[model samples]
Target: MVVDRASSTRIVPRDPVTAFGIGNVATTGPTTVRAEQQVSTDLVDHRGRIDLPALAVLFDHLGGLPYFASDPDGSPCVQARLAISMQGGVDVGDRLTANAELLMHDEAFGTTRVDIVTSTGRICSSGTARNVAVGRTFDHNPTGDRGAAAPPGNSDLPGLPLPPAIEPGLDGRVIIEQIAAGTRAAGNLTELLNGRVDTVDHPLGTGVRFTVGTEPWMGNVFGTMHGGIIAAAVAQGCSFAGQANAAAGRDYQVADLAICFLRSPAVQGADVVVEVTPVKIGRRVASFDAAMHAHDGTLLSRCSADVHYR
Candidate 1:
């Protein structure tokens, strides 16, 4: 894809849009987008920590926000891939900032560089995404229906109101073992979940409490947790949830996964508690909601997933 040299000249600086205690503003050029925000959170988890997944969405959006704002036309772009790497952990009252710049572009494709930093001048995360310009202006504005909405099944409580008890028929240990085995086959899956996760008395569908490991490759640059790992945990939760509600031996495929960060879990000595509950059970499709919390019981992130069982 070719970067548009002519598009960069039609740039604008707009007012910051503030919501959920964060303010975001952007400046764009024809072929590039850069955005900045002072991260703040009006929402808090049980540990009184700032939400983790919610923050991720905001930061992630900031990385792409400029592309739409500066588009010569009003059309919004569709993200094909989003990759995130966290170097540091952020907390409540900790300011998070992001800069998203277009690295490459053409009529059909665009690549962007995304970075997230904290107020203390620490780089929290860095990543990139490939965007497909859908050839239409963004039809909605942030001030109204087009703006951010609460994630599906999102609630004030950080975790499931009634954590599922270990079921009698399924062996929770075997399910956890299967998960561990599955992750081992995936790149760095062993390191991601290893001894960190615990399987209770129930089966794969049961909830597990995980301790954040201090492996050298573990924590973010700031010696805290990374959102990517958290996503992995949530993915496993959804997989198990869907599998549990499906016919025996059925394979589950994740169709969509969306998470919101409410607070950042501590990188070290933090325990992650996640429970996945099936929301809908159709013959082929299933929906699940997963909640994650820090060891101290404060909510960190929430996930909504759609899975297909075949």
Candidate 2:
């Protein structure tokens, strides 16, 4: 991945069709198209964190939300406080990997810096840009005067806090439930029931929860919940994060995902909880890292996934 250097001119309107360069393709070379397609595909998978440009795409598709920064044309663009970019990882059997994050953004310049991380969660590429709202005459409109203390569009980019249970419709909780419905849980599979929203807008972490019953169908020969069950639970949490990030307006597709089986659960009936951590909230892409654990604090499994916002 090639990250562009952050600069004031970078923010200036280089493209007229799109306002903030949110959809601006930064890297152009012999491999630009191939690399971008790869990144775009990867960001849409459920295995890992989404890419920066993908996030940029989402920002544009979702309306020109100012907190996300935009170019003079009102397209989403990174400001001084943050930067956006993409990174890649390896794909082993049954396992996926990638990384993403929010580096920095310029509140004054209306730009931000972001670093694309690899599967191991390391920065691989980076870039910077600035933004300004030019009126119809191509005049610079001071964006900071509405409420000096407020952010771009003012207020904390109005968003919904993640629900604790798998409550769809209320916030697309039904979709998660549908994904979990037919799936068989290990050990007392019947014990598993509908989920509930655990935390919304978590500062430390976020995700949903469900009650699993110790049923006979849930176990393999070892009499434990199958690894598939754990993986599904973790994946569901990641999906929840995507839905929450999109605010139920747009849909997200998983590009890639990675899950590490840590331990096997001894009991079939237990309160399973999945925690989602937002690694990077880019314009076209969004990433969420999640882990599954039992009520007794047993680390059942951990997973990270990236989603394409469109």
Which one is best on TM-score? 1
* TM-score of model 2 vs. true structure: 0.38
- lDDT by residue (tens digit), candidate 2, 116-189: 33335554444332332222231222222211221112121221122223322343333443434542121111
Q: Candidate 1 regions off by >4 Å?
A: 1-17, 28-32, 36-38, 69-71, 135-137, 140-310
Q: Best by lDDT, which number?
A: 1
TM-score of 1: 0.42
Lowest summed lDDT window (length 10), candidate 1: 10-19
lDDT of 1 by residue, 182-245 (tens): 5322112222243244443343344444444322233332333444456556655555555446
